[model samples]
Target: MAKLLALFAAGPLAALAAEPATVAPLTNSGIAGQLVQLLLGLGLVIGLIFLLAWLMRRVQQIGPRGGQVIKLVASQSLGPRDRLVLVQVGTEQILLGLTPGQITPLHVLKEPVPLADAEVATPEFAQRLMELLGKDQKDKP
Candidate 1:
């Protein structure tokens, strides 16, 4: 059985070895076409990667907004590790004080504050920058 299998395998191998092998000579046009094909394949892979990344970002952005029952309306830093966060639950807004040690409930608002009203206080850096810009404009001849 071993000899029979070996003979069968050698039969094809012997025929292939006896046959004259044809080697296609490389041409400039052939090489250029192969290079173009390689470049196109590389571009396709890169474009697919970018498309997946963009799809992931869009999916992540859409995921959070749709499923959120509780939303943070505003946040203010009281100290280095302490913060006041106002969150809207259903129609009620609750103010929470957060520290490194614990989270505390501060107050529940009777009327929901408009989102625009919450950002009324300008940041200190922004205020100072505006002041400097105003001074520069005033000094300009």
Candidate 2:
């Protein structure tokens, strides 16, 4: 009955209730050991987060007939949070106005408009600067 009473009172104390307490004290290996343990735990958590993100990206790439057929042909920013986007869907092309909270369809082209590859290579400012300076890029030193 005393053992049962001791068990209810305390866990390790139940073994020898009559004798002086003889439990071994926890040893501290010091600050360096604790810092190394803390860094390792943080590194593990960060590594797992990156691993999960990479896995999600891989899984998303393998979804629904490879990828999306709707292509963003071009985008022009109107304001800080507003944009005008030209999107190509299958055989049709659409001009969309995108705001902070709303997406409005502005126009739809009757014929498919091809995206000019040259537009990406030469910017408007460079062409204007060349014209003002009266110098051809081909005649560079």
Candidate 3:
């Protein structure tokens, strides 16, 4: 058993000693290939980040802003008394559909009404809104 172990260790040492180191022929294209691969990977990552940033900016620019007055052009009532209001803001137009009791901004008036008044008198305003919705639904089909 001891002789077998000694032969096994000596066999690997002899094999390693017999193998000689050799160098392959230098190829200039190898460096260029690695450089091209690295550039492509960097460009792909940068392009993806740029696209994501552009999308976020587009999404943020779509919503309403403070101190901006929106004008109501027209409104239409859909089925089941659902109402839609068309308001023109800065350079864009928005459609707001209201229900029986919903909060909406009245921004297109020459004089601004206080928020307290709107909150204090809800029944009258809601009644008027319901009447408007009823009239609109009747006028359309």
| Candidate 3, position 6, lDDT | 98
| Candidate 1 lDDT tens digits, 1-141 | 999999998999999999999998866678789999999999999999999999999988976677688988899999999999999998999999999999999999999998785345667887688787775323435
Who is ahead in lDDT, 1 or 3?
Answer: 1
Off by over 4 Å in 2: 1-24, 64-67, 117-141
TM-score of each: 0.45, 0.56, 0.34
Instruction: At residue 99, give the lDDT of candidate 2.
Output: 97
Candidate 1: misplaced stretches above 4 Å?
1-42, 61-68, 100-102, 117-141
* Whole-model lDDT values for every prediction: 0.88, 0.87, 0.70
lDDT (tens digit, per residue) of candidate 2 on 1-141: 999887788976655766786879778779999999999999999999999999999997787754678988989999999999999998899999999899999999998888785535458799789878998666755
Could you tell which candidate, 1 or 2, scores higher by lDDT? 1
Best by lDDT: 1
Q: Which model is ahead, 1 or 2, in terms of TM-score?
A: 2
Model 2 is weakest, by summed lDDT over 10 consecutive residues, at 115-124
RMSD of candidate 1 to the true fold? 7.2
Tens digits of lDDT, candidate 3, 1-141: 999999998999999889896878877778889999999999999999999999999998888656567655566777676777766665555556687888465344443322332233346676688687775323434
Q: List the residue pairs that clash in candidate 3.
A: none
- For candidate 3, the C-alpha RMSD (Å) to the true structure equals 18.9
Model 3, TM vs. native: 0.34
